[model samples]
Target: MTTVLFVHGTGVRNPGYEETFKLIEKAVHLERPDVKVERCLWGDKLGTKLNAQGASIPLYDSTLALDEEEEDYSIVLWQQLYNNPLYELQVLSLKPGDETAGNPFGEKPGDELNSRVERLNPSTELQAKLDVAGIAEVFEPARDTVIQSEAYHQALQNASEELGEYRDAIARAIVAQAMLDCEQQEKHPPILTDAELRDEVVKLLSLALGEAELGIGDWVVKPLSQLAQPIGTFYLKRRRGIITQSVSPTPCDILLYQGRGDRIRDFIRAKIEQAEPPVVLLAHSLGGIACVDLLVQQALPPVELLITAGSQAPFFYEINALYSLEYGEPLPDYFPSWLNIYDLRDFLSYIGANVFPNKVQDVLVDSKQPFPRSHGAYWTNKAVWKAIIPRLP
Candidate 1:
């Protein structure tokens, strides 16, 4: 059976896969039942795994860890004050002649017993105590040789780089802890009063932790398999005729593949090996770049047809000099039957419009008409399929 692999774009969450996959799958089944479809899933777990393996991932630092630490300190301080009831009474019960008594408008008789005695003197012994706790020694240098040696500077640089990795570890830990807390709390029966608010707070904390964990880094450079699995469920659904597919590879990632087209070509080659019939690559945005790169590297099977919508092929050629990258191996004098469908408004696809330097047949589908959404609504456009159906061998 013919195998169609659907790759999705970026910024997608798990829920998005569910909805989009269903649409693509339904469309595929209606059009070709014998064809096997697969959706690729790439999310938090995949992103994390890639980062752990030394891939550079983008992460967000919200200072949540620091804020949590500060809040915990404040809570402990407040609890200590409440526990010592005598501390409050000692300040309020001062009277004339008492050792701890204070003059109505002057320094107290016993500075040690007076809670507010520090407020009475601008430069007092109590102030020195606070300063010694490091609050006033912020500029002090470390006594260790490691802090002053040339090796120290090198270590500092290393530390700076490791901070990024450290924060990522902390974020992941927080997410895991939050998940465990949520599960534990759910086991207890509901308490009707203030517990409702507490429950809501717990839920919000869990979500925040998850966001921090997932935001640890960008996972694009990771292995395609890592990125593929999370998206697999969607592709699997598409294979089963449940959802529509969309692919948007990052610009940087596409650039990498353009230089070494073998990455994607190898992936497709593996899939072709798995199934007997040829594979159809439905690509969008930068995904088209990857497809072009693949075409240049190897003699791909007689691809039934190559379909690209809102693609960025022309930009690669136009700015090839600036990017310092090769346009793929030259296309054959007679290229594969190709359909390049694009809307005028989608500035992304327009980059390749009106130009087919490679001699590939370019069929522009005028989606300027008012029905389907312009940039993203490629697959939904009936005109798209009209152009595609005849070309499919």
Candidate 2:
């Protein structure tokens, strides 16, 4: 039986697996029950554990010592895991410590005689002069007393808090690492070269920057047109320049775009290799840009079909003219059988204009309603699905 593996993108939790699995199962069973369905849980636990270990010393010395970027990334990654539907049922709860003042060490006085001797014992010299070393030893104060003391209690609380913080930090780190690893896998796939991955990154970054520029007007612009245009223009131009320079084709010593793009490309390539073949890649928003990078820059294997809905493709063209400008080398061709879905009103989808190169075709779905917030609903829209299902094998 053919197998289907679904890989979720960022800002989701492990627990979200069940709901997603059910959705896929329902869709597949109705379509093709003979095909087997399996979920490969890329848990953040291990990654979290590793992250915790690495940050343990830093956390111990000063929580402030933690890298701000790393910490922020870790928190975002963990929150995603927490929000995931797969492991929602598997959430772990902390247990309250036993309230009883019972001895945790299981140590007690030796006997009645020993207890009496301890009570009657005088100075150390008198005990030694009496040649009662053995008895004195039996009557010695219990070391376990400190274990049950208030000082020890406070110490334990501090330790527990520290341990919990470390665990949380590590879990977030693991999720981040897993995300990075997943991206690399997608880029390299099972059979591809680093050079291809590098190239794809440049292309995808160009596309992403364009999308960001187009969408900025909706979020960044204020009602007053006078103030909005200048601010928006400045932001757009500056970011556009950054994106263009990053992808410049030169033999310069350090290629910033190559590094960033390579990281994302390599991650995607790795994800592709570990999973079954003939997969359908469903990417949304910025994820779509990454997918494009994987396909165009990394030279990934063609899947059953590529579906991108409410994608940022249109914005890439609006934000800058660089993508449209004729360059020395020809633009790369990608996803010949690709399906690009967009909502006419969704600003993020960049749907209302001609953005893609002449080679690529865009399929506009009515979205059953006007554009805008309906962008994300494109995947589930009956009309959108109607267009996409026919294309899928």
Candidate 3:
């Protein structure tokens, strides 16, 4: 019978390892019942622990807060602008207008302007300007979306008196709002990804209305930048515990391994020797490094296949950091078949095929997660299992 010996990666301790191991164990048993599954469980004995009970971690203080406070605040402010491009216009319209005598003409400026504004078609007017600017694809759906919005109609009615004086601002707001709506829905024809381009688009739309230069959304940028430091400091102070707990493990494990790794390799070899014949070593992260080093230094005949998920062994080999291998040396003839699994989002995972040539097979899987989560996502990913099951001895 084929025996799959599971070896865990860095930073995993008893209860946490038990939870993750159960996931691996259940998956194997459900798919290949005939195959025997066992765990090497080396982390408890050989893994790095905070011997000083985390006395090394520095404490957070007001002076130690993030340095990019203004930049971060600008990002947040821009995100708000993107989500609600009409906010500035809304504010402008609500502010008290200059008191003046009634017009002696047939119609008031507000009434005359509102009539013209209601008749203006975004597709035709905005499209003509956008065409000259070569961004014509953004008009149709954007126009359609704005005209259908109840909020758009309400804003027009609520701000009718101010509309005559702030016609340009109102026009730019409508166009900007339409573009933002389409962009959020992923239907914008052109990628208005840059804030500069978005500002230019608003300018073009205002120009299309035959309006002079009007500072539509410029009032809040400076104020928001000023507010960033205090807000960021308070947030950081509250989230210090959460941030440290989530990010400190992996790097600590790596540093520990670089400083002391012999105990980990010995623990792995002993487990391999005790396991049943035709053993497959399924190792992850730093555990993969130890397995590769062990196989390269001394042959383990019982181990038929070696699978490394999100491993850095190839990177270590290239850097001349792998204990048993050097930069230009080839894998020994006694080494078993190697399957390297990686996820595109997992930045730590490195391809081994380039380093080992035909001896290693590299497979890509999507964990549908971002960076750090992707590193630990392999065990739950179906693509990982499909790749491994067929390669079992």
Best candidate, lDDT-wise? 3
Model 2: CA > 4 A from native: 1-25, 32-261, 302-304, 317-336, 351-359, 368-373
Q: Model 3 clash pairs? A: none
RMSD of each: 22.9, 22.7, 14.3
TM-score of 2: 0.38
Tens-digit lDDT track for model 2 on 1-393?
A: 344444332222333345445555555556666554455333331111222433322222111111112222222222233223111112221223334433446422112212332243334453442122122222223212222334323323322221332222222222223323433333212101111222222233222212211111111112223332232232223333332322121112112222444554455556666657666665555445555556655455635555676666445545542222222323356453556777654445655224445544577765332212244344334565566555545
TM-score: which is higher, 2 or 3? 3
For candidate 1, the per-residue lDDT at 251 reads 44
Candidate ordering by TM-score (highest first): 3, 1, 2
Candidate 1, RMSD to the unseen true structure: 22.9
- Specify the highest-TM-score model's number: 3
Task: Give the TM-score (vs. native) of candidate 3.
Answer: 0.56
Worst 10 residues of 2 by lDDT: 212-221
Question: Better model by TM-score, 1 or 3?
Answer: 3
Candidates in order have lDDT scores of 0.40, 0.37, 0.66
Per residue, candidate 1 scores C-alpha lDDT tens digits across 238-344 of 32111112222244345545565454555655654565456666666655655665564555664555667777766675566213235553455434555677766
Off by over 4 Å in 1: 11-18, 40-249, 252-265, 321-329, 333-335, 351-354, 366-373
Give one clash count per candidate, in the order shown.
Answer: 26, 49, 0
Residue 40 CA displacement from its true place in model 3, Å = 1.4
